[model samples]
Target: MTSNGTSIPVTADGIPRPGGAGSLAGRTVSRIGYGAMQLERLRTDRAAAVALVRRAVELGVDHFDTAQFYGDGFVNEVLREALAATRDAVVVTKVGATPDPGGPLPLRLAQRPEELRASVEDNLRSLGTDRLAVVNLRRADTGPGLRAEGDQVVGLDDQLAVLTALRDQGSIGAIGLSSVTADGLRRALPAGIVCVQNSYSLVSRDDEDLLRLCTDEGIAWVPYFPLGGAFPGMPKVSDEPAVHAAAREIGGTPAQVGLAWLLHHAPNVLLIPGTADAGHLADNLAAGGLAPDGEGLAALDAVPSRSADDVRLG
Candidate 1:
């Protein structure tokens, strides 16, 4: 569905903006999509979450990323109620681990082939859809306590087998991977993988190499936490005086500047910045319209990379 009463534009370079990308299960999604993890907080503020999601659609966000583990089923319910009537929208979800009582803190792999099948059923029920647009095999680092039986986590071959089986059955339109490393992506890319959901942003450039690899391979790299995942990070160009001065001069939030930097950085990058607050959502969507010049872009690129030890992957 076209948002803000503006038709989805086909850029001069011919790439479409929001809702211009090719179909994912007959749903034309915007490359710059919305990640729906914030919907999990709906239990505390249902109206706000629903409004933010609907408003995101109104702001040209036609693609939404969610997962069965988001709210133990709540987020999907919100998406179902909010966007069910929309004609052209893509809803993506994942399967791999079941959330323990604590939260996404510890993921217990429920991806044995049978369990994977069961999770697909649960996703379908929660999402209120017959076929999922894209289903990712979600992976996360095993905590200290959960690492003993590491084999419990589904291996690449096993996960691929399950996905291929489901694909043959027409349960999902496309397959993707979430939280995978460079090695993992290399292994999966040959299997017709269409997308890779990794934690990437201006402050956290840990995925830079992976991002380049995906761009070279013609795969979509959907980045989560463009400004900051939970806690905010420092400026993009740590030592660049000009970028810092410009950030202050614009009177705009540092976040708006950071997001604008990402949009200008790469063509294959698709950002899914999640927020429960309507104001923050509006600010994020507005970042798409900002055009930072060569000096600004160079200043951001000049930012020094963080030490390997300092980069933390969730």
Candidate 2:
């Protein structure tokens, strides 16, 4: 599926193959991919961190979502050691933020076009790769995280210009956007986005319109907080009564049911659920294979969707 009629083969690890096939920037990748932000917690034991990353590869993880600013580049450092001898997977990283270890927040906005290019270089250098597979420009206009202020409020086209130039020069494979609004995405469509990373889940679904836009444009909708990002006033998918019911009827965990609902909801949706724990990673990988019965699916579909302001722990 490399833009030709010939079929591209995915690696088989004896995991369930249903709902496994999907596209990321014209490259076929597992619909279920691993996110690398959680690796920062494992920095104290680099070997253990690298081992976990390798274990994921063994489990058939092909797409790795990461950021150079994550752990002040510790995550990519581990990836560098773990993936040094291998280049089989597509490594997707993001920009528009820098680590602020001393600040109240872990990251601060760097949304200017120049900062975007510098962050890409940081990723390239940290990852020990001359070129990246894909680079998502993490915007701050809207957030499950920080918002851009004053000087950080650069236009989307300005940010994309540098990314497009890098892609043209072969420094990156494809370009994507994260935390973008529908209007922002529409502006970026001409830049040929391959995927989008937004905060979406079974409960918090304010971005359904944006998700639908991605579906129509053939852009991979990679939900960041897929099980809910655990922000205040936000509900995790596991807390939903319908999700638990689906789990009971489908013989799956609430988490597995929630994730399965996403896969079944749309063919364009891809998942990047992250974890520092090995067992949790296995559970996430297996979520792609869960098969919900009609009743289970119906109960899940009937669950009420809420926006960030409307939901609270009640």
Candidate 3:
């Protein structure tokens, strides 16, 4: 399937494997990438997380999504240890949110110019890298206590000013945005956004307009929750009857079917499904090789879209 008139690439066997390579700020990465958020919560040992990262690298997954806030900086350390020998991997981490010193569940936005610098420095120290591959300026409006009284949120230009200065100083190679709306993108585009990470899935499609905008602008749309797994009030993809039915027909797990739909849904849609177990990681990665039939695709598409309020970033 083509997205916004762009052809979806497939392998010779008609399966999709990473959907051809795409570039983010001149750094090439696989379309199907690994997200490291799961490492923060996995009951498995830290060694298992490290092994999973290495296994992902062996599976041709060069794009890794991580954040300094994840695992209170432990996830980045795992990436540092796993990818130390593999220098070509493109590790994308986010700033603008930190675990509230008061507690673990609530995340506080840290977008102050100096705070942004500190966050980048923390990521640098944790990831064991002199310069970050990509740093996303995550929006604060989506979180707690950062909203402006009326419409006067922190200026995107101000944030970009700090990021650009760091880029000039070789602390960051590229800058992107996270959880931003269409208007936010318009305001930040002049600052040169190479990608946009947002909440998008079959059930949570409120960001469809933003996805279209990203597609039109040639920016990579990296959906964080591709499987619609666990959000505060939203339903998981596995809970949907259509998803299960389609999975049964397609001879794969519900998660695989959901990911396959994403692979076929758009040419610019990059996936970052995270997992801790090696077997589950292998299964998730193999979703790239599953192509749903037209009937199955329609069934997957028929799943109802959840409201925007159901989305709460952890």
Cα TM-score per model: 0.83, 0.92, 0.87
Please give me the total number of clashing residue pairs in predicted model 3: 0
Error of 1 at 90 (Å): 0.7
Clashing pairs in 1: 19-30
In model 1, which regions exceed 4 Å deviation? Answer: 1-28, 103-111, 141-149, 229-244, 249-251, 307-314
Local error of candidate 1 at residue 153 (angstroms): 3.6
lDDT (Cα, tens digit) per residue for candidate 1, span 143-182? 1112214455667777888887888788877888877778
User: Best to worst by lDDT, what's the order?
Assistant: 2, 3, 1
How high is the lDDT of residue 140 in model 2? 67
Give lDDT: candidate 3, residue 213. Answer: 85
- TM-score for candidate 3, residues paired by index: 0.87
Provide the lowest-lDDT 10-residue window in model 3: 143-152
Residue range 1-314, candidate 3, lDDT tens digits: 11223344543334333646666777667778899988976524788788889988777788899999888888999999998888478899999878764743546677777888999999999998899989999885442124433233567788899999999999998899987878889888877788998767887787788888888888888987776655456656788888888777757788987787887777787889988778988888767666766776787788888754434443
User: Which clashing pairs does model 2 show?
Assistant: none
The CA lDDT at 137 in model 3 is 92
Candidate 1 local distance difference test against the native? 0.68
Model 2 alpha-carbon drift over 4 Å, by segment:
1-9, 12-18, 309-314
Q: Which of candidates 1 and 2 is the stronger one according to lDDT?
A: 2
**Residue range with the least summed lDDT across 10 consecutive positions in model 1:** 141-150
Best-performing candidate as measured by lDDT: 2
